[model samples]
Target: MYNLRRFILKHHFVILFILLEVISILLLARSQNFHRNRLVSGTNVVVGNIHEMGSDVGGYFHLRQANKQLAEENALLRKQISVVTDTATNTYTLLDHDTIYEYIPARVVNNSTGMANNYIVINKGKVDGIKRDMGVISSEGIVGVVTDVSLHYASVMSLLHSKSFVGVRFKNSQQLASLRWNTGNYRFGMVEDIPTHVELHKGDTVLTSSYSFIFPEDMMVGTVEDPSVSSTDALNKAEIRFATNFATLRHVYVIHNLHKPELDSLKANFLDK
Candidate 1:
């Protein structure tokens, strides 16, 4: 206690000066309008900056939730679009009047684009109504077909796989082609079976054909690029810039076709006969 008292006594002048300076500043800020306004403005600036930083941090954490919400919205929009298009075109109408395809929102838990047979794993599976042969897509375009499903997860055969073949048609000429991954580029695939006589040009849009039971008709696949005639002179092929960037895929929707089973059963019986 004696040593503490001595130490305080030795520094009393300096301590007193600091305290007086603080008080003087406070008094000046309170008495002067300019000083008071400056202090308030400074406080507001600091507070505003802090609040903005907090908001940015909070938004960063909510990104996944936002993405899920967006996926759901997209699914709803897609369904609505299909209904509208079908009604306008007077396409096939069912007795039940329900949309032929329903979308189940899911997140891509795993994905591979750097392999011969790349597959995607989604967070939803059998429990979520995901089944084998279901179509998977993102907001941009068609992704793949569901090949396997578990209780809580499903695997998709990505369009980038070598074995993948999707029936696609040109948007302008309606020329049909088979889309397949060429195993050479991730950003591009090959469109084959287009006749040499059919008109094709670079940047022509390719879309899912009506013949594909997996994907809804007219879903975008890619744009035509580097079109060429095969050596056989009987067929034409073109490179397509895929619409979906598989490397950065995140959210996807699993498509459930209500009439798929009935259609498959009918086809099976006919084939057997």
Candidate 2:
């Protein structure tokens, strides 16, 4: 109590001056409508900034949880979409395994798009029921196919690979085309074997064909781009802008085909013979 009194006495003039300044400012603000409004708005701005900063900090901490939640939701939503659209095919037949499959959400741990044989590494593996030849896709479109698997990781053959070829259907006539990556540019691919009568418009979207053994039928692949400079052959072909950007791939889904083993066995026994 004695120390407090001494401190107060020593700084009494400074304390009085500060209090008077504050009181005068308050009085002036109260006297002027414009000043009062300015003071309130200034306080509101400061408070709003503080709240925004707090919200940003909180959101940064919850990003991982939010991503996991989004991955789960993505898988569920894609599956639902497939189920809803699988039966609306025109001439293409949806395979039996197409209806008997599940989606395993994964994260791209590593990716390379600058090579002739680009590959992507995902965080799901055999333990998570991820096997070889499973189709991988992103929110935007088809990504790749699982080529190798381990206990906790798997390698995917990216669509940008030189040898990668996917069967795609055009939106104009539902006619099938072969999607192959030969352009060194990762953003574009070549669509071949399109029927000459089926006119392809620029920016027309292409989708996974019903004959796709790896990916689900009717999934988006990309939009048709400009005429292909590299395609010099006589076949009807065009360039397409790939929907999934390989350079920015982060999250993906691995498709689980329940009848793959049976199909493989049948192929081995009958087709091979």
Candidate 3:
């Protein structure tokens, strides 16, 4: 205790001076409005920065959930958009205003694009009203036509199939052609039988023709990537690029036209008679 007292006595002068200085600084800040305002503002800025940093860290942890929600929402919007566009384009000749086409939404269970005869399988079938010869489409464009149907699953002949043939017509010029895929690349195909005289341009929209009983008229098929007239003859050909990427197909819709049966019956009866 005597040693502590001696030490305090030795340093009391300096300690007192430090205490007085701290008091003086406090008095100066309290009396000076500008200094007090500056101090408060500086402290608030530091605290705000700290709170922002904490919030950023918390938000980082929630990103995965937010991203998944966004993806699901985007997928739903794409589905709605596809339906509207298909309805607007393909409802060209609905004689029966009562006719209603039903679309059964399905997810792609299996798909193949690297092979010569590619196919796709969906998670829906007869129970879901998905029948054979129904047209299947993705958000971007046509995917294929249903070829086989089971109780709960259906197989589709993808546009990437070697023997796949689709009736397509140019949007502006109304030039009809046949779209076929013979290569492994699902991004593009060839449109044949477009006359050399037909006016065509790059990026022209190609849609389904009404000649087929399977798909409704004017369903989007692809876009013209390059149009070239045959050098040897008067014929013309177009290289079409499909909008739907077969390799990335996830969701699709199976379209069943309500007027197909009546139309087929009339045509069959006429041919027979």
TM-score of 3: 0.64
Would you list the C-alpha lDDT of every candidate in the order shown?
0.78, 0.77, 0.75
Give candidate 3's error at residue 54 in angstroms.
39
Q: Compared with the true structure, what per-residue lDDT tens digits does model 1 show for residues 167-262?
A: 999999988889999746778999998887788888999999999889999998989877763546588788889988787777778888898998
Q: Which pairs of residues collide in model 2?
A: none
Model 2 Cα lDDT, one tens digit per residue, 194-234: 65656777889899998777988888899999744344455
Task: Score residue 233 of candidate 1 by CA lDDT.
Answer: 52
Q: Of the pair 1 and 3, which is ahead by lDDT?
A: 1
Q: What lDDT would candidate 3 get against the real structure?
A: 0.75
lDDT of 1: 0.78
For all predictions, the C-alpha RMSD in Å is 21.0, 21.4, 26.4
**Which pairs of residues collide in candidate 1?**
none
Residue 131 error, candidate 3, Å: 1.2
List ranges where model 1 is wrong by over 4 Å.
Answer: 1-96
Worst 10 residues of 1 by lDDT: 34-43
* Candidate 1: C-alpha RMSD after superposition: 21.0
